[model samples]
Target: EQKKNITYVLNGTTQIQSYVKQLIDVTKSWNCSDVTYTTVRLEDFFADIKEQALGLVEIYHQKIDWKAEQSDKKVTIAYDPMFRAVMNVIQNAVEHTKENGIIYIDAKEQDGRLTFIVEDSGSGFTKEALLHGTEQFFMDDTSRNGEAHYGMGLFFAKTVAEKYGGGIKLSNSENTGGARVEIFFLSSQETS
Candidate 1:
């Protein structure tokens, strides 16, 4: 039996609306039934997500620092799932970071793995967040409440990565004192 405080909602309507949309996206990622994997050019994959992320960041008045190495490479991935997973990671950054905050995204292949790193210029992960950030329904909010903080973003990303024999590592970025989330996959070894 809870209700929104009208005063708060009225005062923060725009921010709350943006948040609701993000929550909707998070909810949409819960379905895995139609996920299909395909080998895609690294350049295409990078460009697609970059475009999407940039659009979202613009709405929030934020910035991105992108670096993609070896864009000519190819990798087999469930395009949408992985894309949404990566977006979820980025969106997490976008949501937590304040206005004008910068997110660093890097795509690179090394040691036979393809990795997408997303770092946020937000308060770094809380001790609890670092330990269970990817666990289903785990949120670091002290209140431990709110549909907006369902804590599924990283979990969904982790699930998608694991399906491809990869995983996400969470840590505080030494350069920014922010959260760093790296999702990696075993390279397809396709030299196309």
Candidate 2:
């Protein structure tokens, strides 16, 4: 009789623990999905502000060691959520840049579409790093002066750009030997 009661209590406790673990796993997956969605929206909105700030810095030349150029037509798009995506790229550049490093923001129309470029005077990625850089949560093994980098910036940036019917490209600058991130946006009429 006592043995039977003990067995019942043990089984109940085991079942409860199993249920709790399953709930936690589901919650984590949902949180990841939410973060991805929110980050995409934020990026779309921030891209414009980034362009504007770069423009103002070019015109004033006050604290403007960097140079940015944009097309005259001013291709505009409705950005739903604008914070995370844009900031990730900008923050990466700022983090890698040395004091007085030159950053360039340029926009141009090519093949009837608009493209935005962010170039920074910082150590560019190596071939191996660049190849795998877009993977989620990929951090470069090389550290520069103890700088903290999680390696998720480019991944998130690319995600946001694609969500808005655009894409991101990464390369090294031939002129400045720095890093360049080009965002390509097709006109609404063009097929993705």
Candidate 3:
């Protein structure tokens, strides 16, 4: 019995450490100068984001549905940080949403900015959350509803946006009755 218990404890510890390492690997910080920008088509980029979102939802067993709209008009964005920010938004939606929730992702270019919008059918942000969501280590129980979140997702997204000449906006979507997060990236030329 003593040996069996020891084996079980070791296994559990190993699993926990592995999980933590995986999480760290996903959200590792990047220096702004280390990121290189290259021209890429917007539709393709949105498709990649959609794919990543779907995979995360499935992995976490969030039971959320998603719809993605790809821009028909061709446009290019050169900011590499956009990918990390957009992924964080989608994952945030997945984690906050309850079962059977829906997430909407839309990408478009306007006024020399490429905007990516993610809306989740979850309890929208409280006023406090809206105000401080992007602050590092800021988490409110009312907004996330006791989810296993470290509150770094939005902060990282905000950093990515600010580093690339854009910003992040958080709101409650009137149409979806849920949380809406918009991340904008500067135009290709402005990105560099």
Candidate 4:
């Protein structure tokens, strides 16, 4: 039993290490302000993102209940960066949320705007995390050795949002009484 538990923890640690490497690669290549944007239909985009998020859920070994709608509406944005940014938020939730905690995602678009909200049933953000959570390398004191987190997840996500005239907000989820993050974009319309 000890061996199995050790192996499980090691596997989880390996997965996090891999993702951290991916995050580093993203930062090295990110030029969010100048990246090329792609226009995609909402339904297709949602489908693709949902699949990726689910993959993260499995990798992190957590159960998440996804809640999002389909739309024929169109959005023009940087696909890779935006996708990674959204995933970062979801990944943060997966990491901080307890082993059996429930995570929730709500994706939506309205009148040329798009938003992705992530919520969790874990201990929500600290008082400090709420104010400067999106700042680079702003990990809380409780962070493990400051190695597991460089505090770039939400920071990168917020940067991507601003690149496309959007923004991000960190708050406590009233319903779940846990951390909630909303990444949103505005004026994402294409001209005919």
Candidate 5:
């Protein structure tokens, strides 16, 4: 079934082909099983994520008003799965954002913890969504209307963050007027 879908896209219009290619690349990142923690540079991690975000924004037909900033930092982490988590949330942000919306990516390491933030310019999540958004299969209208979403993105992201001695925080971005999510990861030791 997935192959059929891929074939169809490959045979479709140029935009569809591009979107499918981006989708496949992003999909591959999610299947990473290497959970070991190792020292990694923050700039390298952000560069990878920003590239993925660029593909996602283009595929989603959003403008490239993206920004990424980080302080001088280095930390040990299972960056593969964490990259998947970051991509998933940024995709979610794109889904909720209006056309030509702005998305912001910021990160910093402070006091032995690394904090990654993604905020967008869309209708913020409802209060209920902010509270239960991380629950498995919990989709809300703002992020997942009648789409194929299983509501597992944020749930899996939270799980990954937690498994690494960190957690996720969701809230409305007062500045961007959209949903804001912060993923926190401890740099000291691996939890599992």
Candidate 6:
């Protein structure tokens, strides 16, 4: 079946604004902690992924690589939402994985669509959880260990993906005992 047109302008605009505000608040609170904010570039984002992985290693003495596989096709998306989508995926991977766990990212274009896959080597979720993963405030109490996750990350990411005539899917990771979140972006022609 063709993907549904999931764009809701009012809802999307509100979510995007809220997410941007949260990101800005967090960055401002860092003050002078060597945190750098710049236009989101693929390379720079990957660098931050590496840095976060290294910090996780330091804390848990684990080693993992957070690298996105190379692809020939390049698509320029809105910087803010794309960055937030990627950051949310990375944050989820870090939060859910145990020490020494691995997270893998792969990007490619297939069948006229660009795809990004984020997978982690953590405990996998139940089928029910996967089904409802994109619902706002629909956190699985069993999965969330009393953490203060807003549970809106995937919801907003899915919103942004749909706004771009794309789609997002959550499933069990085939390589790891963790979840895999895939974001798909349809070409402009497809949208037209």
Per-candidate clashes, comma-separated: 0, 7, 0, 0, 0, 0
Between candidates 2 and 5, which one is better according to lDDT? 5
lDDT of 5 by residue, 1-192 (tens): 999998877666665555565455445544556355667677777788888888888876776454555534566777777787777788788877777777887766667776778888888888889999988768686653344465667777787678767899999998987889998777753233
Worst 10 residues of 1 by lDDT: 142-151
Badly placed stretches (over 4 Å) of model 6 are 1-74, 110-112, 144-146, 187-192
lDDT of each: 0.81, 0.56, 0.74, 0.79, 0.73, 0.63
Candidate 2 lDDT tens digits, 2-110: 9999999998888667556534433443343443322122233335556655654444342223333333333344332223444456566666667656766664555
**Which lDDT tens digits does candidate 3 get at residues 81-189?**
5787788888888877877667777777777687888888888899999999988778787656585455677887887787667899999999888899999878653
| Model 4 local distance difference test score | 0.79
Clash pairs, candidate 6, are none
lDDT of 6 by residue, 1-192 (tens): 223334566667777787677555434333444323233334454555457556655675555655463433334445445556656766676677786677777655556455678887777767777889887767787783345465677776776677656888889887887888988655422221
lDDT of 3 at 118: 87
- What are the TM-scores, per candidate, against the unseen true structure? 0.79, 0.58, 0.76, 0.80, 0.74, 0.64
lDDT of 1 by residue, 26-79 (tens): 555556666676888888888898999999999989999999885577777667
Ranked candidates (TM-score, high to low): 4, 1, 3, 5, 6, 2
Candidate order (lDDT): 1, 4, 3, 5, 6, 2
| Ten-residue stretch with the least lDDT total in model 6 | 34-43
lDDT of each residue in 13-91, candidate 4, tens digit only: 9968976885774564356455677888877887887898788778767787887777676778777777877888888
Worst 10 residues of 5 by lDDT: 22-31
Error of 6 at 15 (Å): 18
Residue 109 C-alpha lDDT in model 1: 73
lDDT of 2 at 131: 80
Model 4 steric clash pairs: none
